[model samples]
Target: MATINTAVLDTFITLTGIKPLAVDVSPVLRERKAALLSILPHWEGAEQSGIFAENFFPDRSVGHRKKELDDLIAQTGNVTGSTEIKAENQLRGSFMLNCPNGNIRVFFTLSPENPPLIQQLDFSLAK
Candidate 1:
């Protein structure tokens, strides 16, 4: 099991302004998502090794997570469109985004104290 680089993770947070809770880097390797690969120089070896590209989500290295994400991108074209909408009455705090090929539903477990805003940024080109 490879370990995630604290320094690299810190840099990522600083540049993206988002805490690294979880991440998917599979798309970085694909031609469609290769542009994102430049942002992460630390993952070069891992990406070539085919660590996460072949494996699924589990307790593993950041490189593996990226590989898995690339695989996911291969399966799901791209996050085409998204919308910030309210959740159902039953859910305490929930939000969802509709991608081109799929939808991401986020359920907030924490209270409404300084909720994180979901911003849409184009990270890759669609296929």
Candidate 2:
């Protein structure tokens, strides 16, 4: 089993302000609701027969994409800030969260399906 990265998890938790016990947002998390309720917990958990269970070997190397986000941030200066654009098949959102760190803008995409899936996640920090 792939061990969780505490450093990365901590940074994310700090950025998003997530509380384990307070994660009961199944009602508002439309996409998360489908994922948590539809898929059998065992599918993502252990006890798979290996024949049908999908397994993933994780990697944190995302330099290429990070560079692209860097470019976008450069293009969208502080004046531009954040924006959300929704297309027929896609829902895109970008925002500057209230982080202790200087201005930070994050861009993400969600599928237009009933239970949207996060197809993309990118972020940039103001210089």
Candidate 3:
């Protein structure tokens, strides 16, 4: 069993190279994460369009994005649970919003400004 484990680890290292060192989470990242979590409930409820407006980057077409999100909400049903897919960095991440009808995978990127706003957001049905 020990030999098997060693061989598996060796194969992984060969295929993927050495794993990178973990980065320390910064204060900015914590704030961004808090901002995202605070808005998730509003997203689940789908009641406050203003929340979306406020969080999204001003340069984006907020109305269009809201409409797209609304359509997704309509199709997916109520958000029953959520899972973070990727949130390694301060600037961008992806998450899965589980619903009764289906799951929606959301990808987002944040602006480089001091208080980073969501610069881009996209959603798709999870496979």
Candidate 4:
């Protein structure tokens, strides 16, 4: 089986044609929680909140991320260019997007269940 990080990178490259510069793999649960805390407030009661929360938990479900990725595919039609893997694991991994010619932002999703977080998840810049 492919390591989760490799899987994510592979997926991104296959779909978008871009290679991410950095891939942060959460070594422990605490770090993931901390990362979640930083993002939770913005999505507290939004339509996608539940999915977002689910990605942060130990399970690392990707239901939300998949939706986002699908949407991106629909919107962009293509996925290559400049990118960064903000976070990654068996659960969710975020991206710092430097698209063909657009702005930069962070996109994260919990597991394969959800689509990859896309422009909507773009919160400021990837730290």
**Best by the lDDT measure:** 3
Misplaced by over 4 Å in model 2 are 1-90
**For candidate 1, lDDT tens digit of each residue in 62-123?**
56645655554555554454444233322123333345565444332222223321121112
For model 3, the local distance difference test gives 0.65
Q: Which stretch of 10 consecutive residues in model 1 shows the poorest summed lDDT?
A: 116-125
Name the TM-score of candidate 4: 0.26
In order of appearance, the predictions have TM-scores of 0.26, 0.31, 0.57, 0.26
Per-residue lDDT for 75 in model 4?
Answer: 47
- Per-residue alpha-carbon lDDT of candidate 2 for residues 12-104, written as tens digits (9 for 90 to 100): 999998876522223323343233223222234212322111211122223454455455545553333223322222254444522333555
lDDT of 4: 0.44
Model 3 / residue 103 / CA error / Å: 1.0
Give the deviation of candidate 1 from the true structure as CA RMSD.
18.9
User: Higher TM-score: candidate 1 or 3?
Assistant: 3
lDDT (10s digit) by residue, model 3, range 7-116? 99999999988886655555554454455556653444323422233546455554665667668878989778777446656676777788999988877676777566
Point out the worst 10-residue segment of candidate 2 by lDDT. Answer: 49-58
Candidate 4 Cα outliers beyond 4 Å, as residue runs: 1-60, 83-104, 107-127
Q: Write down the lDDT of every candidate, Cα atoms only.
A: 0.37, 0.41, 0.65, 0.44
